[model samples]
Target chain A: MKVRHSRILRTAGDMLLPLLLLFSLFLLLRGHDLPGGGFIAGLVASAALALYIFSRDMRSARQVLGTDPRSLLGVGLIIAILSGVPGLLAGDAFLTSEWYTVPLPGGREFTLGTPIIFDIGVYLVVIGAVMTIVLSLAEAEERPWKR
Target chain B: MSLAVILPILIPLSAGALSLALWRSHLAQRLLGVFGTGALLLAALWLLQRVWLDGIQVMYMGNWPAPFGIVLVADLLGAIMVLLAAITAFAVALYSLATLGAEHERFGYYPLLHMLLAGVCGAFLTGDIFNLYVWFEVMLVASFALLILGGERAQMEGAIKYVTLNLISSALFLSAIGLLYGLTGTLNMADLALKLQDTGEAEGLVTTIGLMFMIAFGIKAAAFPLFFWLPASYHTPPVAVSALFAGLLTKVGVYALFRVFTLIFTQDTAFTHELLLWLAAFTMLSGVLGAAAQFEFRRILSFHIVSQIGYMLLGLALYTPLALVGGVFYLMHHIIVKANLFLISGLVYRLRGSFQLKELGGLYRERPGLALLFLIPALSLAGLPPLSGFFAKFILVRAGLEAERYGVVAVALLVSLLTLYSMVKIWNEVFWKAAPEQGAAAVAPTNNALLYAPAIVLAALTVAIGIGAEPVYRLAEQAAAQLLDPQAYIAAVLGEAS
Candidate 1:
């Protein structure tokens, strides 16, 4: 009975984390127009992940993330830079945003492009870097004689 | 040929990544350390020649052309900063060889150090604002790792405050970039300069963004009210890491403020300049007072770093070519001298286990050579005559007077005297007084040649710059002129920004 209860709790947390992350990403993508942003959304996603780690364990969380957080941060930054590069390639200056459209299978589709990609990059950067820092600090604190 | 411009940044970055991948191998790490710094130093010298001959070397990455591509430009100022960074990184790498133990040596120190060097060099050389933010994060992340490498209690505590404060500053910097991008639709600094020049009626928005950038850089530079994180955190790391950070990181922030203000935001000078002047004065006084209050040797040096930053800001606030030149010259001198002093602190710790002034004394008798080495930079830091510090301050004060800012001149002079007093206090406490009875025996009488080598090299460089001030001063003057003119910089980066 106890094992079942623990498994249920774990499964619920697992479901909840991705939901929170997706919600945060939604907020970030819509940020420049509204009240959300890369920074705040990143913080929210990282916080949710932190909660997941607290409920589960760091090693398990690392497995889910599939890489070192620092590497993730580096990649996020590179992506952010690359997102800005399209603007430059289009003969605008650095960080000058360009918009475009794409078609979906169902019908004619319109979607915002470069700026959202940039925002996603920012979201990943802040989320990955902040989580790396917070998790490192937490683990350091958890050492046996840290007190 | 102008690709000499990008090589300084590229060499260190590629080397840093390679070091990280090969971190487990001692040979690979050391080879990266040597080759990375050596290549950077050579590139700096080569670029200096290019700047001397061709005026300024500009490289647009990926062959995308100006304003559109990420540009790296090497003016005299950028070249000098690159050189200084290379010199200091070289010295610190040497010191680390002796100071960092097996655990630390094995734990990615060289990679982080090289990465930091790359970040600093990138910050110095980049011609765009967003790139500056990226480099700031690069340096900050590397510094965070270096800070907490040993995981001591103090180090962890300091890291927490340092990271939190820096994270907030990076956020502010990013928001400022976002706002600037939203307003002007550009992040190329050269392009922004032209756009901002034509942005006459939007002066309010320009001022707002200017102030935001100032505050952001101010927090990073630790200029006055934002300086609390410095003293709270600087002394926590091992001496070699602290030395590198004290020498390089905050100066990168100061360099950014100098660059942006001189280039893109000169339109809002009245607000930014006056605000800077008062902050400079307050930062000077308060930093010295903090130094006065410190009983630990490294803590005192840390506080003085804050104080010296105030001096640099004074040059910026004065806003004349000569004054800015003085700030640049002072920055160069301070990087070498400050790093040397911190290395000396490491030497002192090697001889005597503690860094508290009360526990250290009469090093004149035991290690007079080290005492002499320490004294030159210490005296230079106090702005004594016939030293690089004095020349730096002389130009600054002269510039202040030329601008008819007598109050600033008075404050700067008084700060110099107070700086001398603090230096003397450290000198007397650490080297002049009788050695403590227990310390006398506990302190080994052995010579640490490996540790002393870097300090000696830096001291020699300090004296060389002091005695050979003509060429260096002229270089600074030219750099200052280029900064004030902004035409060549903009032309190089944005094809005249029409």
Candidate 2:
């Protein structure tokens, strides 16, 4: 027999969502200069997504994802590969990073580079790969709902 | 500036990524498989030509300096191996297009094939030891998935054994790399060559690490006492996949052994090489005897693979200029013939509806064309005169005689005879015997030109390489010279070797 979880635990998992998501975003953006980056952020975000799925159903979880994990996998991989194109264009070796300085509204300089794009691509790939695994395992089981 | 060196990896990689993103479209994936492998073949050929002309083509990823960054280096041996691997991939890709059905396509067969190619290309091109390990893992992952794609019980069983054993090998490889890095403080092969030679201390530690590497690559190469995983699993997959594995997978291990022993771990030749010599003797004897006992079509071929690896290892064990050339030549020869044999076996299965030797019959009467095709590779595989294997075994035996290792040379010749006996057995049972009373299963796509195309093409290649040995011999000589003398390779990568 399947042991269903209590309503309170489901509610708590749902209520904890915003804070977990914001922390994951923070981890993603702060990764360039600090200890965090795309990989860790992806794991955290995937954890949050898994929690939501645990509290709800796979169909709703699919709706929340907005796209299949496989498409995300392809997109991430292409982005990572394409990010190297700029390096190739600059007559450098493949995957060589180039930096640019952008002016913010406060007259401060912000740095941008292909590494950021690469990191984001890595992030998406990790999430997509993990989600693909988790969802496949999850969806292999049969659950009942009204037709 | 050899950007061409990187294309072999990039072509398959991009194809896999593209195929992954377009998972819903079977047509797109199939086209990607075809175009990607075709482009890869062209790129590999270009890379081989570039290496032939320029000597050693080296490309540092992201322009990082050597000894610090990962470099893709294609010398004569590396370039030729990559070219042959691409050749096999192209043929097997064609075979898969016809063999892997709609269900397999839905399961991402095309992407996985490209992924395996990427790992193989990376393994060939990498100039770093640690990076070689990474490529091995990449191959392991893709191949494991491909091994059990249909989730058949036998496939799962075979895959379990393959994965478990390969994982242990990976752990040993990783630990050996870690120990070597700690000893020499470098991961680059050229730099390691210099550092390993120059170090006065840690002689015993170096030998121990060398043995560790041998064990790791030994398992991959399926050498004696560690070759069980190969015969246990190779026949379990589809024939196209098996052909791909037979053509390139074990050869990668043999290549690694040749590379590492020739370049990095030549510290104590007497002890290390003597050990390899005995291993080669046992490997050949057991492999051939195993083949003799097996009644299944692919299983016998699988056992023969182990036996053939022993020949390549014998060349390496001899450790002379002629012997190394023989090893390299044997690698090129065996890959083409073995893959063709496996592919032909698939056609036989399609016609006869079984892989059992007892059930398969009358192919010579039914389809003489297929019999003729089989005869070429089979004769060549058994070391007949004027074929590629004859030249390969001849050079190896001559090298052994020159080196005065008569015992192993005698064993090698004996194994060659046994190999012939097994080939005759297959011929008599599968092609010449009367059809069983139960009758054979009818085949699909009756014309099936696609099925015969690769086998015929590969059979022709075997004949061409046999008839025209001078140019291929020259390539093998150049490759062996580079392997025998590590200074040029080191200088090419690390700027004159200090």
Candidate 3:
């Protein structure tokens, strides 16, 4: 019953998830100083997962994505909240971003801040929240419930 | 110093995260929910004490100064409100432990509840209007998830109505904020106030935008013509969920209404406050009258919440110092009393195995002790003498008379009598009425003290606030005075680093 050309899209879907995941990580890491941030990265990751799920059945899809989205969401919240604690400890208000810089082998340098950590936390949460809804919708094959 | 305010919010949020991480473990959630809210309560009390000893406290976020950055401001009103929120959350958390069956717990209930608490605290403390919108959404999203968690048909139906209406309110709120920011060009409340004085000629435009806020917060507050969602959705949830929603959710709307109107939108009082007064009268009449026609247990209480909110709005609508104090006092008194009443309804459901009044009876012959617990809040809610509601109503009525707002005062008194009548109806049907001959099928009495403790604490609080009204009154008066003149708040927020 399936179309002959569908195999190409199915393979593409499988290939796309990893690439998308890698890009999501890139986005999350570079989010503080650039156009990419945790939320956008999470959305991209979720889009990749959604595509993968659409190309496969629910059980197999769940198997591929082994971790629970709800747990990811919780961990994300924990990280985000804890990221604020450093500011509190430094005797400023909660969530005041602190920073770090790493000297590269060349003359250039890399700098980071708590806001990035917070953004990563946001990234995890958005991915977790969106994927939870998507996977649950994917499971609802009959629209309300599935056998 | 900000730790006092920050911890009240952070403790719950972090606890939510930890518990959500351990979502599979019921034992972990139970321990975390109770202990976490306990920490929040203590922290809130400290925040209140600190604000009490000193004066208004403000903390800028990200080290940003007042005008440009978001700030958390804790005047007496915000401090007391945060304290109340923590207390209610703590009580409800304990109640949830005993009352939420495993299914509800497994459905991420604890995490959402904690998130809801964090949102409410954020709303109370935030000094920026736009930030308030974010907090409201945080609360809305958490509550929306909690509402539809079970995926029950009725829950979804109710949740859909709840979600749709709240979304509209939020959109209106956001647009109002957009227009406000466009108009004032500042997001912070103190800065907005400073800028709004120059909006002298734009009074009409200010009133228009202010009405947008009124309608938005009014929907959330469940005022007249906008409250249908509350009754439709509230009774459909499990009793524990309903209790939490009943206790905290709508009140947040009322709180926002009071906060924005008192702080930023005070330029055209005659028109805006006049509209509020009329809405307050209608909300009270309609809410109580709606309760009269409802035979279900939770539905009746649900309608009464609308009625009670009218009282709070009346306090704001009057806009006098004593009336404002009356409003603040009523806010404290009513939150404890209303929340306790809902918790008691959950207990009644446990005892009787049904929420329908027609199927229930005969508790008086057996559960006399439960009767006392019920009466404390019920009578207090009815404004019986020496209970918190009486003093709350008394101060409000006296203030109304002093202001010579005779018409609304008459409506308030008439509504009080009707409120008493409705409470008695619930009392007669559920507690005093004899069991029907064949349908005397009640569940075995639950000896679970955890189930009873939250209601007991709240009922005791109602009695305490009633018997010892002086200290509470003084606090409300102080809060009202500060609310009247935001000079101290402005100084604390905009004052040079001290």
Candidate 4:
């Protein structure tokens, strides 16, 4: 679909981008304990980016991304692999989840672990892979000969 | 020890990611390509040694127990296949340095190749059936990308067919996994083998699921009736890519067949294995006959891949220790020889500038070394003596006789003769005949070590396997014994809980 520029959409997309990204982060953080996870959160974030592309132009959307989607993929995968290494270092199998307890205010405790890091990695990978495909397909559509 | 189990998968995967991260640097990507595959070869060698000395190696992902979490198991067969994949990947990575266009390299060839290697290794190492399906998709995606990397018209056409058929196969595989899980409540293969043994009332459902896996894996293996996609697409890629696919891809499918039939689907050998036997015979006959008609260098080699797959399945079909040994031996032998053949075909294209036998001639007169390199694989592929293929065929044929499967044995010999005919045709057209009079001034052969080194090493490996067949045969024999008796595998995966 050729999305013609609409001022209202452009304005709304600019306003909604931050909200959507925050919500995605919420989903990623809640992934280990709840139904939300890296995959869904990444999809939601990419969907927000797709909206931004439809309202603005490809150049602006890419400017906002600020780096190649391919690099995001590489970084995400490396992060994921690194997260798995702690398991190996702990004398366990690869990808074994290790937990750490943090002291919170009022004598409370918060649990943290490698799974979150792994989830963040997956989050980046999903977004990067999806955007790479979508951006390329959009660019392909923009060719003058394609018309 | 558990860490060692995953190194083969992890190394290539990280290398792929690293190569992608260094996208702007060609020097880095090239270095990553060689170093990554070389590291994988070393890791595979170490894993094979560990598995040989220590027996089956099993590691549960995330420290989950067997039947509940994903498990990586490196039996001897799995280790052997991993080593073969590393061998092929390393060789092709070297070959690609010479032949791959700069455009393709810039467009992420090395990264994709490494990912493909990771996928192949994962498929070899994973012990869970669902995980196996995931690995297959990993392979399919990377291969599909590699196949159409250049985005040529013919490649697009080939990729469509390849993807469509393979996607169907994957669907079948997933559905079968679903049905098997529904019936038995487990996706762990070792656990499934145990659960399946007790599913007395659900025998028919189990067998149905088994057939589903067979058809699914059969398409991937390029078995009879579902093999059209292989020849349609295998030749469209660059020669290094083709060599990699020829050596590794379909063999993974064959490895899956060996794993499933020998481990999980052994309950009704009369029904399932019997079907495999007939299908294997037909796969052999049809693939050889198909090669007899093709004159294109890669196309001919592609068909031979299908035919060779038949011999492997025949070993599985006969379902005896010796036959399984032969099958394992053939897997090693064929990966080396077939890949070398495709690599040699690339060298031929470089020298003569065509894949069509009709357009090519007189390589023997100009570059006799190339002729000799081609002959080693071509003759061995036809199952000529004192080469790896000869020993492989000898064992399989003997196994067929001992099992009293005379009809398939006869077909096997007949197909061997026909394979020789096709090889001779290539020899005559590409090497023996006078260069078509137009290019009377022979093209000066470019001396590129990257091109010939891989083929020479692989050819030497083939000869070594033949001359030192005893040790290799013993390895296969032990792998076959492990395959025949699932107790060790089960114990290794499930620990004392089983």
Candidate 5:
């Protein structure tokens, strides 16, 4: 389970990690209107984290994340559930999406809606859940004596 | 009004999420577990009352038209099932507070339990077949985690069998859904019902898909030849989990079978129901026989779950109005009684430090209250008069006799005798016999109130169901009438325009 020290791989990982994270965010944002969505973005982000874990170690990966993946999962689910409440409050069915327009400084308008919020929640959950699984399995592998 | 349909699912889902967020705070998680389940019970009650008064209640998810988007529909049966699930969740939540160790609670027991409840409620309330499958997976994942929460050797073994078999069942279920969708071009169950009836040319292919569904749900319900997983795994979890599983899990499978057969697969009942009749007989015979051979408390009770499913299946297999009523009544009666018996078993374990019958005894002399509580569900399970099981069995037997299904009726009667034999075996060893000399060394826990309260309430409900059989019977009859004729459910879900 221990990873060997590889200078080239670590450098590659350092370069690729931020790029993958940025791309995942783009996928998540455009999910409502485009082909990409939260689920795929999550997988991509977790893959980036997995690369970091391999290059450095599980501890560094945990340190980079800075919080337990489980909390991310919890927050994600609550956000999704809350996203549905506005619809219910409006006397519509549960999960009914409502739209709003945001005007920026340049007078450009952006569409905001519950579906995108729901997709963000899905994005977080996918990342959190996949990372939780990958990290646990990797950690479990390190302690072969316990098994 | 629409909130009633979604609240049963949302309440548990929200509680689970909040519990996860508040995982470090045990007190908060515990309170959330209890109050959340309590809220679900109230919501389910409100839903049942609404359905009872207003006929089928439908909520189109996200305001989409039915047949195009998912819908949560609560007919009499769905509402009743949801209510029963909430009741079981509440009872188990209370019992879990006392029984679960701090280690397990910290490992997310409360959250997982609530998630399971949400899944069960969603399965019950959903009007779309694909949605039901999603709910089943949700329930399965939560249950898989709950089963192996402690990571004991035995639990791992049990969970492997449990998960492996269930995954296969899920695959079969998904494939059947895929095939059905391909044939009918619809996934909405009400719309599917309409389209399926119109597809006269594809009757044979439809029947094949129906059989696939039967086998899929049959495995879930632990019907005969597919129930080896139940006895192997159910007794391996902590008794609180066992009680929950015993109470609600298989019954959900039975509920799916009831819904599918009554609602969608009625075209070929001559073949499908006939198959169910034989499965019912064998499930009963084999289950009771398996219990008779077991000496462990929960294992015996576990086998009895499979056996009891037989009687419920008989109610469906008979396919008459009175027979369906009996099926519904048996469904309610079995859930209450089986769960009570499991809870009582947990109490006995606390007192004796073991679930092995040979190591247990003398409860009648030491704890008369526990003895009386035990006797209520035991005798009722044995179909003793003026108890819930008696009425459940009497109606099924009468329905069978009227239908002239003499062979299965004979088998049902025989299974009842054998069921009594197993209960007597537990009684003789665990209650009436002399306690082992070392048995007193295992000190009972101090929180006796929390331990006994749920069982006492459940036992009282068993007695109430027996005494108040008329109203419950009327509700079951109305549910049965609806199942026999799905036009109202179809209209409710797809609107009158359909």
Candidate 6:
């Protein structure tokens, strides 16, 4: 019974983080048109991940993240760069964003496009960068030398 | 040919990765240094040629167009900085070969050094403000690692201070970028420049954004009150690493300040310009006075670095063509000379095993060549005649006089004399005094060619720049002109959209 109870709490913790991360993404994506965007969202997601790492072991969390934070940083940078390319393709100049419409299964086509992608790129960058610093610092602190 | 623009950043980044992955082998690390520095040098020289012969070079990665794509720019200013970075990186790499031992090499030093170089190059070439922030973080992370590479007590203490201060600066930088993006609705520097031009000089959101950006850059450049973190942290690292950090890192901040202030925030001259002038004067006086009070060789040199930064800031604060050119020239001279001096200190430490001036004396009688090596750069740093440092100061002081800013000129002259006094103090203490018996015995006369080679090469370049002042001065003048103009930069990036 105790094992099941602890298991339930573990699953609750795990589930809570991704949900919060998604909510942060929502805030980041809607930021330009609304209140939040890439940076704050990224920070939120990173904070959630930090909680997960604290509750769980770092090694397992690393497995879930699937790469070193440094590589994630590079990938984020590349995506950010790629997001800016569409505006360049339209000859709008570097990092220029353009809006477009994509059809959904419903009767209406929704407004979708590059600025959001750029935000997502920024999201990845901030999350990756902040995590890299935090994780390194945590690891450094964990060493026996501190005692 | 646009590939020329990306190569400088890419080569070092790849080499850095390779070094980290192959950390078990010292041979691989050494090879990484050779190939990385070589490729960077070749690329910088090629880019310089292209900039000189064919005008500004802009590369949009993966065939993207401007204003929408991330752009790598190689105008005269960017290209010259790239070249300067390449020169210092190469020399520092050579110096590190002798200064760093196997244990230090095993601690991921080479990889971090290359990443730091990549960050510096990327910061120099990037045309987007957000991209510049990313690169700044890259440089900062690598610097943090390098600072604490040995994990000694002193290293940890310094690293904590360095990381905290830089993290605050980075946060400010990010917040500024967010504010600017919110206000202007674009992150591209070129796009913002065009947008700002149409927006005209105003006292509202633009000024607020401008102030934020200036504070961010000012902190990074270690200007005035923002400079306290530098002297506290700089003396903790190994000499070669500190030399490279001293030479390139803050200059990257100054470079960003120069780029953004010239292109986007030109309208707010009254606020930014006057603030920079006062800050420059304070930074100069405080830095030199701090140096005058230091008894250690490295600590004194570190303080002098702050003081010299004032001259560079003075150029920008004055904001005339001559003054800007002087600022640019001063940056070039300061990087080479400052790096060389730090490397010489490394040599001194190697010979005497102590950096404190009071601990030992009388090196001139023992090692005349090293003494001369130290003397030349020290003199140049003091703004003595017929050296690159003098010409840089002359241009700045002349511009101050021409503008009839008599007070600034007077301060500049006073700072120069103090700089001379500080340099002479180092000379008198380290080279001229009689060798203490224990100190002289500790100094074994061993010739390490790799270490001295970089210093000698840097000193020779100092003379070369001094002799070939006409062309170099003209290059700086062109760069300064382009900075003041902004239309060309905006048009180049924005193209026909405007």
lDDT of 3 by residue, B198-284 (tens): 576898898899999999999999998799999989888766777778877888888888888888789889999999999999999
Candidate 6: stretches off by over 4 Å: A1-143, B200-202, B440-445, B496-498
Query: Each model's TM-score, in the order given?
Result: 0.81, 0.96, 0.96, 0.97, 0.98, 0.82
* DockQ result, candidate 2: 0.68
Q: What are the clashing pairs of model 3?
A: none
Model 5 off-target regions past 4 Å? A104-108, A144-147, B439-443, B496-498
Better of 1 and 4 by TM-score: 4
Candidate 1 regions off by >4 Å?
Answer: A1-147, B440-446, B496-498
What Cα-based lDDT does every candidate model obtain? 0.84, 0.89, 0.87, 0.92, 0.91, 0.84
Ten residues in a row with the worst lDDT in model 2 chain A? A138-147
Give the per-residue lDDT of model 2 (tens digit) for A1-147.
Answer: 154867986797778766787788788888878999888988988888888778876766677778888778878888888887787778877887888899999889999999888888888888788888888878665543212
lDDT of 4 by residue, B1-498 (tens): 466789999999999999877878888999999999999999999999999999999888988878899999999999999999999999999999888878898678998999999999999999999999999998999999999877777888999999999999999999999988888889999999988877788888888999999999999999999999999999998889999999999999999999999999988999999999999999999999999999999999999999999999999999998899999999999999999999998888888778888889988998899899999888888999889899999999999999999999999999999999999999999999998866423243578888799999999999899889999999999999999989888889987334
lDDT of 5 by residue, B1-498 (tens): 367899999999999988877767889999998999999999999999999998888998998888999999999999999999989899999999888889889678998999999999999999999999999999999999999988888999999999999999999999999999988888999999878775577888999999999999999999998999999999999888999999999999999999999989888889999999999999999999999999999999999999999999999999999999999999999998999999999998888889998889998998888899999999999999899999999999999999999999999999999999999999999999999877644546455699999999999999999999999999999999999988887888887334
RMSD of each: 6.5, 2.5, 2.1, 1.8, 1.5, 6.1
Best by the DockQ measure: 4
Q: Which window of 10 residues has the lowest lDDT sum in candidate 3 chain B?
A: B436-445
- What is the clash tally of candidate 4? 0
What CAPRI grade goes to candidate 6?
Answer: incorrect
Clashing residue pairs for model 1: none
Candidate number that wins on DockQ, 1 or 2: 2
**Model 5 RMSD, rounded to 1 decimal:** 1.5
DockQ category of candidate 2: medium
